[model samples]
Target: MPGLGVCLALAASAAAPPVFVPVERFTLAWTHSIEKVRWEEDYAVVASPTAGQPPVLQARTARVRGSGAGMEPPDDAVLRNGWYEYTPRMGSPQGLRLTRSPYTADYAWCVDGQCVPLGQWLPSDGGVTLLTPCARPPAPER
Candidate 1:
């Protein structure tokens, strides 16, 4: 019976699929004028509306298991404005969704309707961070 149990354990281990865990997801939104930036730590967040224009910026980040294959850590550009979709090793048919991207750098300042390039600007710490509001897909023109 002990031998049978061991066999069963091995079989289960072999059959077990992979699993994925999300590190975190953050989102930042800025108005077209780029006057102010709003941040959301998780999904389904509603930011207080600020005076600005349309064309807000959106960013997302996620840690995936099998999906990370061949994909390198998100780059600055990706961290700045990339939509991430992660797939786990095993479990549900639909994997977790880190709908929002975390701020990569620690500091974010706007000037003349543009986010200063990374490195050029500095947050309290050297850490990276993101800034913006929730993003919606472009609407179909009438």
Candidate 2:
């Protein structure tokens, strides 16, 4: 992916200057507050369809345990070990906005089988966090 120089930009509502994570691919994982089911979505950084646009997140796969409420698994999704796995219809999004709450566990930013609380990188303070693909490495935080 030469010329991509891509990274994931994590910007909290209050974090004027976002902290970036250098990754070509990663997963955003979390557990349901009520159902306690694990949900994970894998994403890859790829060149945008437009000729000169920055890279965008191509959602690769999505998996979750159990289905109810807003967690219904697609009919084509396969079930194994109580987990439903399938490729997401999401082609690419300009960005993803996650609502951070103090009650539930923080979202997990997983890479290379390592999962870390996103709070470790940027403090959301019960605010919203935006994730998007960046064309540059993050600048050193002040």
Per-prediction TM-score to the true structure, in the order listed: 0.17, 0.83
Clashing pairs in 2: none
Q: Among these predicted structures, which one has the highest lDDT?
A: 2
Clashes of each: 18, 0
Residue-level lDDT of model 1, residues 2-104, one tens digit each, is 0000000111233532221111232222221222233321222232244442222223223312113344333431333443333222321111221212344
Q: Give the lowest summed-lDDT range of ten residues in model 2.
A: 1-10
**Residue 63, candidate 2: C-alpha displacement in angstroms:** 0.3
lDDT for 34 in candidate 2 is 83
Off by over 4 Å in 2: 1-15, 49-51, 137-142
Cα-based lDDT for every prediction: 0.26, 0.78
